[model samples]
Target: MAANGINSVALPPKDGFASGPLSPGEPAAPGLPLRSPNPLTSKVTSVLSTSYADAEFRDALGLLDERGLANSAETRRQLRLDIQKEVIQSNGDIITEFGRVADQLRRIGTTIDKLNRSYQEMKSHVTAAHKATSSTLDEASNLIAQRQDIEKKQHVLKALREHFVLSEDEEASLTLTSEPVDDRFFAILAKAKKIRTDCEVLLGFEHQTLGLEIMERTSKHLNQAFQKLYRWTQKEFKTLNLENPQINSSVRRALRVLAERPSLFQNCLDFFAEAREQILSDAFYLALTGTSPSGQEDRSVKPIELVAHDTLRYVGDMLAWIHSATVSEREALEILFVSDGNEIAKGIQAGRENDLWRLVTDEADGTPEFDAVKALNELVDRDVSGAARVLRQRVEQVIQTNEDTILAYKLANLLNFYRVTFSKLLGTQSVLLESMSNLETEALRQFRSLMRDHIATLQGEFQHTPSDLGPPDFLQESLKQLTSIMKTYETSLASTGDREADFQPVLAESFDPFISGCENMAKTIKPPSVSVFLINCLLVAKAALAPFDFTQKRVEALQSRVDEHAEKLVASQYAYLRTESGLDTLYDALAPLQATEEDIAKLRTSDALKPDVLIAASQNLDDFLPSALMDAMENLRHLQDSKLTRDITEEATEKFCVDFEHVEEMLISADEAIEQGQTNGHAGSQDGPQSLRALFPRTTGEIRVLLS
Candidate 1:
């Protein structure tokens, strides 16, 4: 079995046959008795047996033996013959079975193809049907919506007609008067009438052509009634007397009734449309032309009386309606107030106030006019406090409802200027404060009104909550400027020896109400509470400084105490640290430090242990600390200067600047440590001098040589 075909076994000959040929060859070769095989032979036999018995070799040999037996010529020939016969029979059977299988597969494939075709056809049919159905449904829905809208319009028209009580007799008697109704009024009336008629026609068409089973005829009649009422309102306005005291009041009443419960009236649209024009015209004529055509002064009419009466009536009506209406309707009306009515009233009031003041102050001559000026000035001084109180009340009221009103902003701004002016008037001989107060008051009132209107409009349109009202950039700047002016005014007032005590109470009284109002309002606002607090603090500090004499050490000491308190308050309130660097790196590390108790405990034990950690902590408290401290110091310094002979402003400013710079320097050092730690990837860790030097590359080379 070896590849070389070497004989591996050596066997002894059979018994007594060992001699080569036992022949007469040279003395018979010794009969070599068969000797047992050598131990080496046995060993070789065992080795060969073991090697041949290997499973792999044995398997191969067995396979070879089977093949050899199978390939023997006799067996092979017979087997070949038998195999050829068997193969022929088997192939016949295979061919028969294959034909059967192929036929079955063909049938199955054909059936599947038919089913697939049917499924695709059905799916497409369903999809097409669904699309057609959806289209029909959408058309029906649109038609329903249109019908509903038409009905609503008709209903409104009917209500308008009933309210105006338009009759055939009145329509017949209507004619163009000497002072013809303006074309604008007529145009609006015509538009209202046309809208009514259009609704009637549409209703009729819906009934006749569309076969809509509804009360179309009744709706059409209602629309016609509204049209008549609209025409009557126009006629009434054309004949109205602006000079009659009762006329303005009546018109306002009518407008309110119409605006609030339009649904109750049969001709609501006609009434509203006509009334809108009439009210404006009447208001204008009453404002401008006080007398009638007879040339007698209209003794019965006063512009302020007319406007105040009408505006109050209008506001009352609106409020009543707001109370009665559904939440949604009330909201809608409120939006309208913000968008239209409030702004108009504010503008009219401002113009009226300006004109009245101008007339009252006619040329600065020193006779009765001078006396009048002085009296009015004194009156303004007295009334300014009252005005501030009223304004604060109004602001708080508006803020309390979680509602915005243009009136609120207007009031806030007006009060701000009034307070500032009052302080200035009490302090300086220069009329600058007085003039500024007047101008700023006017501006602030206007600004407040505008902001309120804007906020109201936004609230109405977006349904904004109280939290939505943020102090816009303009408002913030306005507030800041106002604060600055007040601060300056108070400083000036404090310096004036004659009126120092007088100004202090006035300033406190004026600002206390405003601060209180703002605080109350802040509950309903967003982040502005912080601003309110800061402003209040500023005002308090200013007021405190106003009465204290600068020359007295007691005043200075009191001021210092106030400053300290302010600084502490700011530090606690802001919870910031004073540092040179910004908080980015410090904050990032502090987050992880907080998660680890060991780090926090370490910080508590050793103040200087984690420079980065401390820096981070300090940064959080820094924002309020410096500003608060500065404000406190400024107040104290002002108090001292008031009592002293020195120029207080210059000294206070210098000290503030120096302290602020020191705060900045401290912040810088903390930031530097944080940055170093960040760069070295071991924030706030204590490192050896060498390691620290390596972390800070600039120090590396010098420190390395020293360490070596």
Candidate 2:
């Protein structure tokens, strides 16, 4: 039944199955094979037929057993036949069910055959439809192409029939290439002109593109040209013609030759103006930003300052070479050196910054950027200042080391070195002149400072031992050095034609301290010694200052003061010598001496000035006749016959004479007494008749001794 569900029949093995129709020799149908008989079936059949009566088992049951056994055997036979019938019946049922299955299978096979046929027909139809579609598409494409061709041909034929059809004379006109033979030729010429005009218009478009390309190439060529020119300039100007005496004129002549023909520089001017902005921008960016162009690492390229400076110099030289170059090249160079698209004026502008003038233009008023002379001067200033600074440092070092003396010649040597080096590197006449001027000023300043310090030190030295009034060697030597320096400075200035070489002011200024110092020192000494040494110092100072014309008056003034001091000292000494007490002592001792013999004997033994003492004092006065004070007085009188000393001496002398008159009066009284004695006839005794002459020797001797 399970096999019969799909309409297939199962039969015994003796029968063969068939699906559609069975052939005689073919294997059984695709359905399950027919069932074959097994041994169990046969065993069951045998068991059904078996009986105990057939052998000893039947006898062992006795009569009842025999009867039962016979009955059983019969029953077994019947059962065997029943079993065989049942077997046949089962076979028949199986074959019947198998037939039913075969019929159902046959129907299923027929349906499958029909479905296969339908599938084939459907496939064929699909193929046919695809072919028809492809053919239709091809036909459509071809029709469309043909339609387009037909339209194009129609359009062509229409044009040929209407617009392209030419008259015989028009065709002849087209063939004409030269002078017109007739009206047709003239028409052809007119068309030709029109064609030319059209061609020219078209060419303008072409030229626009081509022109830009040409300009690009030309720009590159110009750059390379400029580069070569710049390199050449660098080489040529490595040492500008500063070595040659006529370098300025030579260069100017050379530039003038170029400037005489301005047309020759037109191309250069155009290129320079066109390229300057870009080049300056590039240089500026590179200098401040350290940037380089794409793919280039030349950030260390030289700055534009030198390029601008050199370019301006070249331009200036050219202009200066031709006096008319200013008027001619002003416009060209204005464009060339323009910054910010604004033209820099020819001269420096008051409102414009100086740095702007660094790229100065030729039209500038005062100092053109191209002025080589001015450039040389500016460079010289830098070099000289640098040299002066270094020389000053060296001089200061020398000053520190050799403070005792001035380094005037050494400074001259340094100045010479600076001049030579400047000339070798950056010299001109103007430069040298200016540099010397600066050198003189610097050297003088430094020397003056050195001298001032020396004088201060000398002043200190004088102040330390004012009584030691002699000029030390160092002092004299310093003065000598100062004189030498002044001379050197003056000579240098004179060589440069400098009219302001007067150094008298410095001399007087430096001497001020010394003069005041002497006076101060003089005041500290005692009177007599003060006069002595101060005079010597004054004379020394006068000698020291004698070289300076400006200091003559000052020296004379010092001499005058010295004389006054001497006279004052003298008067004080004379006053002390002739004091009333002093004269009274003399008078008391000598007044009692009479012309009598006994009084004269007493005067000889008295404490009065003895005759021998008087003689010695007189001799000493003679020795001191031309005293130092007197000499100083005479010297002062010679310097200026001023009455200051004379009045002082006369006043002091009158006081002295008054004191001496008392001594003279005592002598006179003595003389009178002696005379009276004589007159009274008392002269011949041993103690009588001693005259005043016995006590006093010479007439002026006593007065001279009193004065001493």
TM-score of every candidate: 0.18, 0.33
Top-scoring candidate (lDDT):
2
> 307-399, model 1: which lDDT tens digit per residue?
444432323332222222212222332332223454422422332322222213333442221222332233233322322333333334433
* Candidate 2 lDDT over residue span 278-298, tens digit each: 333343344323455443546
lDDT of 1 at 162: 48
Clashing pairs counted in every model:
37, 13
Best by TM-score: 2
Regions of model 1 farther than 4 Å from truth: 1-226, 229-281, 284-296, 300-442, 445-708
The ten-residue window of minimal lDDT in model 1 covers: 3-12
